[model samples]
Target: MVTEELYAKDSYIKNFSAKVTKIVPSGVILDRTAFHPRGGGLESDTGALILGGNTYRVTEVKFEGNEIVHVLEKLDGLREGDEVEGRIDWERRYRMMRLHTASHIIASIAFSKYNALITGGNITPEYAKDDFNVENKDLLPKIVEEANEIAKRGIKVKVYFLPREEAMKIPGVVKLAEKMPPELETWRIVEIEGIDIQADGGPHVSNTEEIGSIEVIKVENRGKGKKRLYYTVKP
Candidate 1:
């Protein structure tokens, strides 16, 4: 059965109660979850599940088809139909939220200034990186400046589902050059008000102001026409 993904609706949900539906060698499957499975160039959420007064550490989370599986350090006493309380590592998750939002801001800035498209990206609590299809690495400093300017604007970030056809019509909605979002009737779109809008299914902060400031840590030349920017958000 497909797990009801609470994270998709609310990235701020840190804890949730769920009933175990299945148990595998590695982990257990829940009927619903706020734990985000690893995908979309983002890392998975890790924490603990409390069951029968015992805590099991969630080492990993991933999608097995449409089902969300929570890999545990040990299955122990968990069983089907068992109810448990799941908690996410909020400190880490929040960092990623800020980083993910910051990446979008940087991507938007790159596109606006140089017409660059996002070739790739990865998000982590420590730092985030995005690759853009641009030739000149000299624009790194300028891009960083523009990104901070936008972040200081305190733009309101909004997430909503739109019909695939309508979402595609919005310019700059699909910034990734390598792949397209899953083919679904309604696509989840994340928008930073006037700054950026793109088809995304990942956790993000409610406002750009939450991102504080982003520092460009490194710029790399990944062969012709590929420029990579690595950045970290200040607490």
Candidate 2:
């Protein structure tokens, strides 16, 4: 069964209530969830499920077809149809929100100023890394500096949906070097006003100012035309 994804509309939701739709050996499936599944290069969110006085620690969340599985530390007491409350680890989720937006800021700068395209990336609570299809690793320092300046502008970020045909027509709608947005009827577009716009699904901060600043912690040469930059966000 497809679960209602609460996070799709509002990333700030920290807690929610849902009924247990199913139970597997690994975890339980809720009819609705705010827990973000691990996908789109972002790590899964961890939290706890409350049923009565007992708490089940959510270790990892992932997608299984259309269903979102909330892996739990224990399943001895959970049953299908039971109601439970889900509490997101807000501290961790907030960090990811900041980092995710910072990634977009850096990426947009890299693409616009240097003609680079994102090859790959991963987002975690502590840090974020992105690989670019650019030859000059030296350019990353300038990109980070530019991204910081943009972050200070407090540009409002907007998320909306558009028809696939219409979205594909936009320039730079897909910045990834090797992937495209899932072939859905409508594409979710994340636009960092006046700076960048892309078809994305992961959660992000509502404003660039929330990112505070970005730091280039490390850089690597993946191969010809591929350079990776590791960075972290501070707020």
lDDT of 1 by residue, 1-235 (tens): 7799899899999999999999988899999999988998899999999997799999889988877889999987888999999999999999999999988888888887788988888988899888889999978768888888988988899999999999989998888886788889999999999989999999999999999889988999999999898889896
In candidate 2, the residue pairs with backbone N, CA or C atoms under 3 Å apart (3 or more residues apart, or in different chains) clash, namely: none
How close is every model to the real structure, measured as TM-score?
0.97, 0.98
**Candidate 2: worst 10 consecutive residues by lDDT?**
106-115
Residue-wise lDDT of candidate 2 within 139-221, one digit each (tens)?
99889998999999999999998999999998888889878988799998999999999998888999889997798899999
The residue ranges of model 2 lying beyond 4 angstroms of the native Cα positions read none
- Global lDDT of each candidate: 0.90, 0.92
RMSD of each: 1.0, 0.9
> Worst 10-residue stretch by lDDT in candidate 1?
138-147
